[model samples]
Target: MKDKKKWIIGISACVLLMVSVFFVFNQGKSNEQVVTEYFELLKKKDYKQMYQMLNSKTVYTPTQKYFVEKYKEFYEEIDAKNIQIKILDEQDNVIEYLIYIDTLAGRITYRNKVGVKNEQIQFNKELIMDGYTDGCKIKITTYNPEKRGRILDRNGKVLAEDGKGYSVGLVKGKLNGENDYGQIAQYLETDVETLQKKMSASWINDDSFVPIKTVSEATKNDLINKNILGINGVKISTVSIRTYPYDKVASHIVGYVQNVNAEDLKKHKNEGYNSTSVIGRSGIEAAYEEKLRGITSGKIDLVDKNDKVIKELCHKEVKMSPQDITLTIDIDLQQSLYNEYQNDKSASVALNPKTGEVLALVSTPSYSNNDFVLGLSTDKWNALNNDVNQPLMSRYKQTYTPGSSMKPITAAIGLETKAIDPDKDLVAKDKWQKDSSWGNYYVTTLHAPSPNNLRNAITYSDNVYFARSALNIGKDNLFKYYKNLKIVEKIPFELALNKSQYINKNQKVSDQLIADSGYGQGQILMNPLQLASIYSAFVNNGSIYQPHIVQGQTKTWIKNVFSKETTKTIKEDLINVIVDENGTGHAIYHDHVILAGKTGTAEIKQSQSDTTGTELGWFTIMTTDEKQPILMTTVVEDVKNRGGSGYVVEHTKAPLDLYLSQVSD
Candidate 1:
């Protein structure tokens, strides 16, 4: 009985051992088979089968058709005939394979991962099954799409369009100097060195097919007749490159575009930007980037190893059409203002009095927008960036002491708070003595003998009168009224802005400081935009209108800050600043329209000299005939000849005359 039991145990042990060996052998064979299948599929140009053999769990299933379409579209053009595949790793649940495909077009490679599931491998079946559809064909043709858009003036007048001008771009890195660089450079009127540098710098390493140059006016005729082999790398792309027919006339206001950079890409990545694209970096281009970046559309074709057509994979239609924007700006007025400031370091801002629409914003020392359309050279970019006058900085963002421009705002505030009666007559102490110790500083008047009233005080910009008014009203009330008018604060324009600063009411407002603050001095700084908007409020009754550059219909109206009565009283007071005969801005005044305005000369202290640097300027105005009170401001920084007499009224008159003549007529 003992012998029989021992025999049974021995047999059971042997059976268990045989079963274990068979299981191990099968597992090894299964792994080897999967690795072999992966390589064989790749060797056969069966991408779909290979994809299926990969670990499916880690692979992402494209959630959208767009994502899959992009990958499939690119892979179809790739040649898999020379592809070499190797097994990189094999674990219980993970497998990795390395693929190397070689072709004259380019070397394509990738590491694919496959997840083992129930001992079965899964991959992209459709991709492998498509095989080499293009293997039978030899000729391959590549086609790029056309660029289309319109260029219009403030009033929809076409300036330059794809239909009118021809543009051609060369594949950035594709042009070879050893074979065709010298010939191409000669044909393009550029040197080989220059072309080489441009091509090298512009080519984004990842994608060499993208055209570097945004636009070049080389026609088909130019390319065909020149016998330029480099032309083979060129592709005809139709895009609208807007020119101001009068190039430099409105360059600053119209702004310009340059080839986008890393910084621009980082800032606008979500805005659908790619390298080799143009974006509005400044001026209207920057202000209207969203509206002007037209929708992009393209056709994606699927082809095989021999570049032969496969089934049409997918063709997506982009519907981002260019939008037309009509600005309140008058092109004629903008041009005329540009002409006036052609030779000076000057800036002017003109706004519609009633609606607060910016009609013209001009700055001199401008460059042609066309220069930027073509990428700017290193030297050209340096010249503009390093210029002492800072042509790149729009003066509207520049803040200066408003001088007497703040007088009207102060006066309006005084009347509203009842700090002073408008009709009261007061004698200007021609000389205001701060105290017994400070002695006396003489105040100048329109009439030397010194006649003083609210009208005469504003017309002459009487420091003494405003000084006493500020003292009586106090700084707390001073800032309150100024804040109400949106002075001493930002006006939320549709662009990046530098914040304006004003004295805190809680800070000390001594008699001398109060006197200086009253006449636009001591501690006050304002940008041209702030002054323009504030003056607009003073002119258009008391309602502060938010200034806007974009012209379009909207569902909401900006809130009104002042009552109707306050606006009426301020309008009457502001008119006296221009039309009172003794007014400081009288030089630019006209009765054809009920024009109201003010002039200022802020003193700037220089380190080199005892004499103060002066910013000569004038601001504010309301016109009745145009049914729009125009608020205009002009500033000429560092007038060399004017010592203390820098308050020359003519600087402001130039832009004002240009604006009124165009709009009033």
Candidate 2:
């Protein structure tokens, strides 16, 4: 009986619809006016008035609440408040109206029909809300977000940018059969079972629009060409994907963006973040998130009991666009450095000693930033995390023994303390013994050079000369000089910089241990960046400028840790290290530029008790070009019974050559 009644009501509704069509064709002034009133009510979102004007002759008419919800669902992406409707024609009481919907994606226009009779209106709601079922009426529309900011090098070369992409989603409960699912999978270039599994995890019901996967433009185009986007339950949306054009070239510096996780969503909820938001996870991306993230806006709709959108209450447009960020790094220089030392476990940092502007910093064994942005598979992510080389660790921040590099710092301390004269000969030998009060400790020289004054001491990297100088200057005075240079303190900068370690304040240090510190061994460890900044004082008239990686700006000078005269005297000694044939770094001398550098090799003991251990080669050089001066520190780790500080000088020459060529151009 119930089925029969429903059929009778359906038949009655069809008959009334036919009559309303005929009445609409008569073209009465009252009917035309009613159509105008219905659209006017729609513009004001006055669902109560719009529902009242619908023709009541139909036996299958929906309730007022459901009626409004259906309209809300139909115009989900549109700003109904700004929607403009105009009458195109009214030849037969049938009014053809044009609806203009302003959307973030673009402006959309479509035609809607209205039938009028006796000051009443009737229209097929199904035409506007396709595939809408009677029981489900809630609607949701995603607004377009502004593109993420571009990351550029100092020279305005794009390092990272937003690229066009697509996201595949499923409108739950809309699929008809296996054939429909298979067709969609085929278009996505995936098997039906794989696509089905993804949908199964995200699926809810007919009302849910669950995103299944993100695809490239090629996949989206393939699906579009196959006409699969029109398939029921399948949805496709264009998105802005974070793209790294240079890939892993500056991976550690530029970083990458990824979709917000549940933890981040909860933590950043107050900041207007959602599950769909993309955020910087590390490096420059994390350091300057506020400037890089784009504004997002969308419309909010209210639904009725039958899951229909009753009103589009508000529409918000993005207020701010993404801001472009420029880094001080030179990508060309950075890539050149990376390629030359990619095989070795090493790091190199190049900066303008005068301004403290970093030109390039390279840490080898880097992983691809693109992989992180696109989302890393578990296996790939694990491979990187578990790799022995620790590709993710930024060697720029890591600390290492300065080796004989500390000799320069010790020399400056000695000059300041009046412990050594610049021209005085030290008579360097192969070995020097510590005093009986300091225990049985003897310092050995790499190669003994006769008439070793401050100049030859630095040129030959003589261990005994520095050891004797450290004893003369005293530990208290040496520690004070290191503190004044801020060598062991955390550097002030945007990126994370680890602090160097010094001898424990309370620990008793014998004279021999203090002598070891002078030769760049023992307990002292120096961060590459901090060491570079301190070395800048040698070229910048004894004043250390704050180290920075952003272009077009100069960091403030911390202080003149060494006097101008002291630096001038020390610079001459440093210059001899490159010009003197007996110097360890003399092999790296170039005719186009004057090079002043120091080379040191410190043993990395496996344990405190293991005196025999692997060596770490260290080299710091200043390419003294009047127009563009570059100071760089290169360290080669785990050099076991192999080439010593010489290898460091070899690697340093490549970048110096590249940098000089660029400057010459």
Candidate 3:
């Protein structure tokens, strides 16, 4: 009985030992199986299976709120149905997965770096694992459509076109080897690295067959001679570039083009800008960017690895953009005026005194359109931008003190408001002074012993007379007239404006202040264009017309704020300023036409000095014939040699001579 019991115990112990060994080995195998199965599921994009296989302790439990909050933080579009899990690699302890997600635009793949853990994974802690896929990410390639538009003169002369040109493209799958890159770069007279970088930067993984650059005939011949293998990827297409036969003549007005950058893309993305686009940077190019940048056409060409074209998958027919715009400018007159101001630092604006058509607008210190077209280098761009005289600045848009130019407007306001009588005779007496609540500022006549009457005030540009007239008209009335004349604000025109402001004054109109205001002093501001237009109204029987740089546009007429009779009275008085022997503008007078005008010199203050700058000489005039009268205004700022009002008359003679000589026939 003892022996039998011992045998049973031995058997039981052996059975128990065998069971323990089997359980230990089975557990190890089960853990290995679980890891393998989980990785396989992740590779097959079966996230649910992988989640089920995860060790219970390390498994994550997520709430709807957690996902919602995470989605908001990343600005990501997350949908349970569209989430794809792709296992990138599984090594000793770490596993990487690419999670492809569906967005509003298309599929965006993300990378998740996950590690094995024994505890439950927190959703907030795992958020950092979501990152953009680097290796598996799709490389985006951008196509920039060519800018197609016509270059036309104000008269609608086509100077350029969107036509066919030779271009170079890479085959779909071809690598740009050193020899191929060298051959192309040498032909183009560019650096090999630069060419390679540009090619690499422009390469899009999805579409690699498109032309990289448009080359000239000379470059094409050179590439052919080199027997370049990948040269088969090169293509020829019609591209539009600005062409100017007149070159430097109209460069300032026509402007030029440049490559679009990152900032430009942000601002003008909706306006049809892409990665490889060109845009107008200045002149008519900038102003008419929308019109000039026509609709772009696209095509899909299948290319091989060697950049060899296989077939065109799809192509959208190119459509001709909108018709060219017509400008109301006279080309001949523009050339003539430009020629006139070529050597001098001056500007000329000629309008059809009857219709207000800008026949010619010319500013000196102009640049060549070709230089801009060919793509200016950094140094050249800097020189142009940093020029001291600011050649790039349009002088017609610059503002200046109107000086005696404001005299006629002041006189007309005085007479129309009945504040000062037309025939009121008062001696200018050379110097006039008045004390007011604000300390006195002296008003003087340009000529000594000046005539005091309204006629003499304009004729001699007598500050005292205007000052006394300002007192008569009152500050409120002066402001009203200026506003009515569009002097206080910007006038609507195609060109931009530098707005003028009236000097602020005390509530009560003071005698001395009124005097200063009357003489075009105190706080008066006027652009040369404004002064010219106002003078035109003064001489055109009170008919104020909007000044236009474009020709053939309708004349936008402003009602005669002053009646014809009142305008006639003002015109007669103003005639003395040019026709009278001692008149301020007498030097510019001619018997062939009745030239009535005024001369003014405004003092400018310089910085850090008690000394004042030389005067800005001014001349405003009107010429009348059987047809409607023509008006003109000229200004010469900081006259070097001839200072004061004399310089104004001297400069006025040139335009007057040209106008009379050209139009008298």
Q: What is the C-alpha lDDT of each candidate?
A: 0.61, 0.77, 0.61
Q: How do these models rank on lDDT, best leading?
A: 2, 3, 1
Which ten contiguous residues of candidate 1 have the minimum total lDDT?
136-145
After TM-score superposition, the amount by which residue 481's alpha carbon in candidate 3 deviates from its true location, in angstroms, is 1.0
Q: TM-score, each model?
A: 0.65, 0.70, 0.63
Top candidate (lDDT):
2
How well does candidate 1 score on lDDT at residue 482? 62
**Candidate 1, superposed: residue stretches over 4 Å from native:** 1-154, 158-193, 196-242, 262-275, 297-319, 436-450, 504-511, 553-566, 606-609, 626-629, 640-665
The C-alpha RMSD of each candidate to the native structure, in angstroms, is 12.4, 19.2, 16.3
Which of the two candidates, 1 or 2, achieves a greater TM-score against the reference?
2
Q: Please give the lDDT score at residue 341 for candidate 1.
A: 65
Model 2, 1-665: lDDT tens digits are: 99999999999999999999989877655665777676677677677777777776641445777766757655543433466668888766678777765544234456767677667676565324323344534344544346678889889999888897777878767777556876666555456777667667743667677666676666578877877767887888877788888776688888888889999966654345677788999888888787787555555444666656765544556676677888888888898888877877788888888888888878877878877765555567889999999998888778998889899989999999999887888887897877566444568876777787888888888889999899899989988988888766778877898888668667788787788898888789998888888888888778987777766668665777899888887787788899988788899988768888888898887653576788888889996665868898888888665678888888777778888888889
Model 3 earns a TM-score of 0.63
Residue range 128-176, candidate 3, lDDT tens digits? 2233221211112223345456666556765344444454555535553
